[model samples]
Target: MADDFNSQRATLSCFEENKPVFDSFKVNIGKGGLGHGLGEVEFAHSPLEPLKQEGDNKAPIGVFTLDAVFGYEEDIKIKMPYLYATKDLICVDDSESSFYNQILKTPKVMPKSFEEMRRDDAQYELGIVVGHNKEQIRKAGSCIFLHVESSEDAPTAGCTSMKLEDIQKIVSWLDKSKNPILIQITKSQKDEVLKLYPMLKLEE
Candidate 1:
């Protein structure tokens, strides 16, 4: 109910420098693997997406942040304590979850509770957090992230998907000063977003 995120009809360029920043992105809504921009990715960033399955078809347009990180110590080292396989976790604001992406107020970490959630597996393997709290964008919510893709061909949920090598490369290069990974929509949505939040417009 709390939707504080920027919509596609609001902005254009979402980068701070004229560099080859963002690794890869989705265009042509609902397209997986790859897509070409109608004109160009005016913005250097991208937006968070809704949860997705391998064959599902839908691509949302909204601005988002890679708020925090999570995963393994040997591989994905999210700076925060958003550990998976623990009992005290939940993806609170999700329509996909019968639990709706919300972790229970009661704290108890259990992996069995998540036995049926293979879609959420990506959150653990990769250290990419998402902006799924459409209920509010401050990020005070539940389970979400851009974890390492299960299969290179695996479709993503709202969160952006990338390879382990890609994630590691991007994370290392990303300016911690820019803590959040900005996911901008394509040209049409970019323009639409700019119309709404003129102040947040990205500079080309």
Candidate 2:
């Protein structure tokens, strides 16, 4: 097991130079859970306030894809996060509302983009591209990206949030030759990613 772990770690380590393939991955986090470099994508970026199909604060979970990109006007061909932004996107809910609890597509503009809904929170102004397809993960919730937060006073509606510069760095790094996709997440979840990937193991 130790040898296997080490080998895995080495393989992933090699990916480090690969540019954009995240060094680690997972789905979990808590308050004060933050990281600078790439990491495991979390199930929920901001679970403090969820969309109201009536009224409920439920964070999304489960495996998903790193689909298309957003925000950036000009498309810069990269491995992943091709011009994606936290402007608008997320796996809609399942309860099936006229609007709530459903995977929505981009340009859901005017009709309350992710930024407007979380305006009160600091993570707004950012948008996430929903990764999960109801048919794929079969999970009961949504999954999306994390980019440009509104600020630091509150949590996101359920999407992750990062800085514009970091987003640009991340986008540029992601190339098909490497990770091919970008996964957003926090610390608590990063541990689990270490266990699954082994390549993320640390000496300390």
User: Top lDDT: which candidate number?
Assistant: 1
RMSD, model 1, all Cα superposed? 9.5
Question: Which stretches of candidate 1 lie above 4 Å from their native place?
Answer: 1-18, 22-59, 74-88, 93-123, 134-144, 193-204
Model 2, position 25: C-alpha lDDT score: 26
What TM-score does prediction 1 earn?
A: 0.50
Q: What TM-score does structure 2 among the candidates reach?
A: 0.47
lDDT of 2 at 201: 44
TM-score of each: 0.50, 0.47
Provide the lowest-lDDT 10-residue window in model 1: 1-10
lDDT for each residue of candidate 2 in 1-204, tens digit (9 for 90 to 100): 111100111111113533334543222221222222212344333455222121122223333345545554444565655443333434334334344334345443323322222234433233345453334332233434455645433334344454555455555654544434333222334555556556544422
What's the true lDDT of residue 97 in model 2?
35
Task: Rate residue 72 of model 2 by lDDT.
Answer: 41
